[model samples]
Target: MKTLVIIVASLFAGVVLSAPTDSTTKDSQENTYSIKVSDHGVEKEDTIIIDEEKNIEIFQTVDSDDAEVVEDFDAGLEGIIPRNGDSCYVKPLNSGENIPPAELKSRLESSGSENVIQEQGDKDDDLYVLAGGPIKNRAVVGETIAEKCEGRNIYWLTLAEDGHQDQGRVKRSCYLYYCSLRVYLGKGRYYYHCYIVRYLC
Candidate 1:
């Protein structure tokens, strides 16, 4: 009788332990700022949803065929120019004229501008000379002049005839044009134009 009683007691204990215990759960929801992307630009109208269960759902009709999209990130690139530097020899105009760097330097020196500057690039493809200086006379006829004092950003280079000819032609034609820009790095921002004919030789 005692053994039977013990067995019945053990069975009852097991049944009680297996019964469902108390459980309390909490539900949480939140809104996060988000934007939808389209070909035109950025559009923001809805919020991203997140629950206490770590589940996330975003409601948006984004165009997958968009040209570009930028995520949440930041980046950039850097470049610099020397205090005294030269630019690569770009064709002065849209026309054809092959002038040697040495000849160009000589022509610039003759301008008679104080502090005539010439900076050569270390590489062959670099601009051989960036020659410019102050001119005594700011006012001239048919010439473009730049002045930093006046908060002006651009001016023109003067063009005049150089008596030397490149090939069999005694007088090759050189059309002069005025050029100027505001963002020059040096101290002074004035220069005169020098004209020379392009010789095929």
Candidate 2:
């Protein structure tokens, strides 16, 4: 069954750190969102460009030691695009109400997640897949963990390019976590990867 729905419209706006020395132009889409940058000491307005998939293109540039990195959308959270210089990643999840907790329960194993993708031979770049079942609160489950891994507190594991995340500092706590269920549909056999993240309480 297909579980992913791609939104093909412009949805957000963001600041690009240092617009390349070459040029800075506004997109045809006329939707711009503003954000307050505490560090830059200035409020910047962002331009939003919607693609065919409705995935928001937030124009933000991160300055790396080697070069300037341009990011289209928020890498950590959807709906809210990150300001330039903000260190984070946002990946859009499959959004809808059809995903039920029961379906989530059937998909995940209690002890360990499946199709674990490991980390590359580096400390910073890594990825993995986390899975778990339904939670007591259906509302929370609807947000992140969706119906794919329903019936238990939301849980997830890290998936890196090479394989499962396994290294120093980048431990299980760093990758695997429990939070309000957030769901996203991917391009292959597996449609969902549940991540239950909890910030400082």
Candidate with top lDDT is 2
Cα-based lDDT at residue 196, candidate 2:
23
* Clash count, candidate 1: 6
lDDT of 1 at 101: 24
Residue 90, candidate 1: C-alpha displacement in angstroms = 61
- Model 1: lDDT equals 0.20
Could you give candidate 2's per-residue lDDT for residues 1-201 as a string of tens digits?
Answer: 011121111111122222212222353222232221211233332222222122232322211111111122222223212222222222333345223333322222121222222112222222333333322444432232232223323332233444433333434342222112123232111221222221112
Candidates in order, TM-scores: namely: 0.15, 0.20
Model 2 misplaced stretches (Cα beyond 4 Å): 1-30, 39-55, 59-158, 161-201
Each candidate: how many clashes? 6, 49
Query: Which ranges of candidate 1 are over 4 A from the true structure?
Result: 1-25, 42-46, 52-54, 62-201
lDDT of 1 by residue, 65-98 (tens): 1111111001110011111212111112211222
TM-score, structure 2 vs. true: 0.20
- Residue 189's lDDT in candidate 2: 14
